[model samples]
Target: MTTSEHGAVPGLFTLVLHTHLPWLAHHGRWPVGEEWLYQSWSASYLPLVRVLRALAAENRTHLLTLGITPVVAAQLDDPYCLQGMHHWLANWQLRALEAATTRTASGPSPASAPEALRRFGSREHAEAERELVEFDAYWRHGASPVLRELIDGEVIELLGGPLAHPFQPLLHPRLREFALREGLADAGARFAHTPRGIWAPECAYAPGMETDYAAAGVGHFMVDGPSLHGDTALGRPVADSDVIAFGRDLQVSYRVWSPKSGYPGHPAYRDFHTYDHATGLKPARVTGRQVPSADKAPYDPDRADAAIDGHVADFVDTVRKRMRAESERIGRPAHVVAAFDTELFGHWWYEGPEWLARVLRALPAAGVRVGTLSDAVRGGYLGGRVDLPPSSWGSGKDWQVWAGERVADLVQLNNEVVDTALTTVDKALARAAAVGAPTPRNPVADQILRETLLTVSSDWPFMISKDSAADYARYRAHLHAHATREIAAAAAAGRQEQARRLAEGWNRADGLFGALDARRLPVA
Candidate 1:
């Protein structure tokens, strides 16, 4: 680890925010669809980008490692998504306005109106207005230009993952390699830099996956601490490869968000689940975890600000103490990494972005060194070789969540879909070669692979296991699975016209990554 320049703490801290969501374009828009995308975009992505740009103005570099999965990048840059996002932002402003005026102008008597509701309306309206302007100014084009600014400026290290965020451990080996390469290429095309590290979907991994990383020029990847057997003081070289595996430091990470407690549970923070039905705005504070929504108190920005300050200090102290102790016990400086879903900041925990900003500034002030994961590797934070077992950051820190008994059916469906897709594509290629008309981009085969990848995404199994919108998850998985089967079957027969028609129709609904080519699939 790098020594503190001011003789403060002698350890390193890396914060990784994995940004991803399943492709929701042209899908349903309520409970769990494009709504999910718009909420995260307005709440998390917009604010997070603003925070980074603010810090960048102060000349901060290596602030954090941000993993924007290839599938998400595709949607962010897609014309359809951009148009939809604009509509969402405008609608948000309208809702906020309605909340501010609906009760005062036409509801129950103004004297009987709850002051808390009025306060919420005013605050939300102001925020919505500001966000609308922000969206129009920077995000109207898409997330690419703004994200590219950060990537090119070196404000953060971008981590790229496979197309569609498939859980690699359960994937066929050839498909896994194909997805990784295509995902990296997608990132390269969007940001003009191919990421050297990836936040493996769910931090999922299997032994010997390092050879694939090495082949794709990926220098490092993240895994859960249990996968390292909890000795996570430093990055480790996996097996016999030069690729490094950094494990999340759960001891420190869980301090902010955990199974039992975290700062977001504080009473002053905005309650994520409680909503104002009329305006669809969350108007309550988390007065108590088990408290009923009716009894919850109105959110107070001042109180939440105090909570953020306290939590930031507590987190910095935790990191400092943990690092000092671990460094002593390990006979050297320790490197601590804290990874979380990017959506957690503003979407799940309303005050999370502020807490994050304060923590980033406070850690250095408290003498703890902060940098990206690349800095940790370059500063000699690597330990001896480790042979990892199959692991994920999911429940049990094992593969059970994605391949558990609960999702056995999905596992089987994924297998069948992938096999049919690969076989169909192989035969199509062979036939084309025999006809002396090799094609660079077979629309039918490409759509088959696209649907196949979407069908195998880890999100489906995760949602099914967690039961958080399991029905929607099931619908999406099977929807893509059916598409893959029909498209592949049509192509496998001599029904060229029918295959093209099916592919074209599917393209209108499920299409993302217009650059995806069937030829990119490995032939061996």
Candidate 2:
């Protein structure tokens, strides 16, 4: 255990935002694919970046620890995605204009409908226009340079993760290692810096996983609070390795968003689900859970702004109280980590970014020290070593979400696909070695590995289990599985031409991590 400059402060707070989405490039567009990516980019990423850039201009360093999984990084930097996102932004501007001119029949009177739409359209148009400028300036080329700028400026600490955000604990050892190593390399390729820490997909863990982290040159990662058995006073070294695991402090994190209640559910906030189909905009406030979309009140920016203010102050007070209490209980200053999906702000909860900005500013003013996970580790906010249990941040804080009966078929599918892909790749490597090839960069083998990794991504099973997009999840999982199977079978059967053709097609659709090489897969 160790202490640091924060020993005198009540507690130190670190905000972790895990930014991830499965590879949606060349996938479906509406309802559940690239739309997810672009919507998050325009609503969350753009605004979040705007807020961070503002803070960075003010010279705020270590504002938070941000994890941009390699898969998401690949999309953000892909030429196809950049083009699509630009078009999406332009479409948004067009939608706003349409909304302003389109008459609706739901308002108090016929006259009221036009007035309401005009106001909504005008406001949305300006917001979309601002996002467009931001996109052209910082995001035209890709998100890499923008992200790298923040990283280099020390505005946030970037955390890397596996190539496709696989649930690590359920993955094969060799593949797990390969993904992590490749993912980190991918980050370095984009941002020019390899992250020392990772927001482990799902905050999933298993005993001795820290050894994997240590072997991969990772100094720290995250896990769930329950994995630490609720003793989240500080980051803990795992097992005998020097790798640290920072557990999320549910006490502080749940205050912003939780299952039953959170700031976003407040009536003043924009209703995420209530949409104006005619205009393709959300036009209602969360009047009440029971209120129908038709009966819900129109969203008012002033009310939402007031709600954000109150929530921000309340959150700051919550952190202060939590830190003070934890510090007194532990006989020293404590550390609190609040980890959440980055999309929750600006995407799911419309006012989330504003609330986050206010909270970040208010916390320091209220005397709560803020830092990144790296800062916490270096500041010596570490407790005794702990042998972590197999766990995830999923429901019940266990591996059931990814491996449960609800996804038992998916589990089997993943196993079968991975086995076939690995077997096929291994044979390809052996053939290469036999042919006196000096390098292991087999294109067919690479595509097999790529499709295989995408096949087993934790996102599919999660989406299925959560029922958010079960059919789409199953479709994607099987789509990749089928791709891997066909490619692997073709290669394994000595049908080199057929395998190459299949690989090329899949590569065009699922191509990501251009640097991924099957030959580089770690040997156990």
lDDT of 1 at 234: 93
Q: How much is 406 displaced in model 2, in angstroms? A: 1.3
Superposition TM-score, candidate 1 onto the true structure: 0.96
- Give the CA lDDT, 0 to 100, for residue 161 in model 2: 94
**lDDT tens digits, residue span 1-524, model 1:** 22254347878999999999999989899999999998998899998998899888988878899999988888888888888988888787787777666544322223113566667677887888888888889887888889999988989999999999999989999999999999999999888899999999999999889999999999999998999999999999999999999999999999989999988999999989877776778877898888887677778899999999989878887888889988998999999999899999999998998888878777777788889999999999989999999899999999999999999999999999999999999998787777876565688988999999999999999999999899999999999999999988888888989999999999899889778888878986
Please report the candidate that would top lDDT against the real structure: 2
Candidate 2, lDDT over the whole model? 0.89
What digit string (tens of lDDT, one per residue) describes model 2 on residues 1-524? 01232333576899999999999989899899999999999889999999999988888889999999999999998999999999998999998898778765544322226666678778899999999998988898889999999999989999999899999988899999999999999999999999999999999998889999999999999998999999898999899999999999999899988999899999999888887766677767898888877677777899899999999878877887888898888898899999999999999999999888887777777778899999998888999989998899999999889999999999999998888988888888888889785965789999999999999999999998899899999999999999999999899999999999999999998889999988898764
Q: Model 2, 99: alpha-carbon shift in Å?
A: 1.3
- Candidate 1 regions exceeding 4 Å error are 1-7, 104-113
